[model samples]
Target: MKKPKLELDEPQPRKIIRADKAPTEGYSLVVDGHFKSHHDTVEAAEEAGMALKNRYQMLQIQVYDAVTKTRSMIEWPAPV
Candidate 1:
């Protein structure tokens, strides 16, 4: 007797931040400097801060009106 082959696959969960409509007013994303781990949301950011050894600082982030795509960078004195 021959056995049938089995296929194994798993899906990974990820966070998606979407803007249905562009905001007339600009917004800011502040990440704490003490944050160490990778973050996908504000809650994750806080978790990263708690995990870090040093004091966390707020990182100032500015969203541009013209740009359609979002971009991120590592800044000193991170924000929460």
Candidate 2:
């Protein structure tokens, strides 16, 4: 018997690092549909996400780019 392929739906907008243009191209970190914090650069936003994940014991954290409209997941280390 042949197996069938599964199709996944396009991912929706989630936690993202929104790049603000009006007041400088700063990046903001969002989590669980809420605006958490803002950073001067994307790297800072990513680092903030990592800290938040560890501090809150989040299962997973996703990051999206406001300008490019792309998404990525934050890699979390396994608990010791």
Candidate 3:
């Protein structure tokens, strides 16, 4: 008897995002739904996330609140 071969596929976004676990004990900065950085406070993480999103409008940036257990997406600003 012959066995069938299996095929594996992976998603490749424009920018390679790190496959890391988000901070479970503090605020975290997530990029493209993947864990990016950890911050002591929510404000710091929010600021960094916003700045990165504002600079690169193509990326999906977000601020994750570990305490509240929620994630907020950083919407791109409108053209002036």
Candidate 4:
């Protein structure tokens, strides 16, 4: 028996917004998805982080900025 092949297509647009700082660079908000990367730029990374949080209610997320060579894990629901 031969294994079946799987095909992947471009992601559908759930929600897209023009980044204030990076106007030309837009962000896509996906549903029931997880994203992982080690790219630079905290702001950009955080934008994605917050998006995931807002959409999926993720309590925490990890971020790594190659440019600054920094890594940190951000958590939500901080003590008042």
- Per TM-score, the best of the predicted structures is 3
Query: Where does model 4 exceed 4 Å of error?
Result: 1-40, 67-69, 77-80
State the lDDT at 38 in candidate 4: 27
Residue 76 CA error for candidate 2 (Å)? 1.4
* Clash count of each predicted structure: 9, 0, 0, 0
TM-score of each: 0.22, 0.50, 0.65, 0.37
- Model 1: residues >4 Å from true position, as ranges? 8-36, 54-80
Residue runs of model 2 more than 4 Å from their true location after superposition: 1-25, 78-80
Clashing pairs for model 1 are 30-79, 31-78, 31-79, 32-79, 57-78, 58-78, 58-79, 59-78, 59-79
Ranking by TM-score: 3, 2, 4, 1
Candidate 4, position 6, lDDT: 83
The sequence of per-residue lDDT tens digits that candidate 4 reaches over residues 1-80 is: 99998878967977443233222222322223233432245677666766656666645565544344344555454224
State the TM-score for model 1: 0.22
The Cα error of candidate 4 at residue 43, in Å, is: 0.7
Query: In model 1, what lDDT does residue 27 have?
Result: 33
Top lDDT: which candidate number? 3
State model 4's lDDT: 0.47
Give the per-residue lDDT digits (tens) of candidate 3, residues 1-80.
88987867865657333447555667888888788888889889888987898899899988889888899887778334
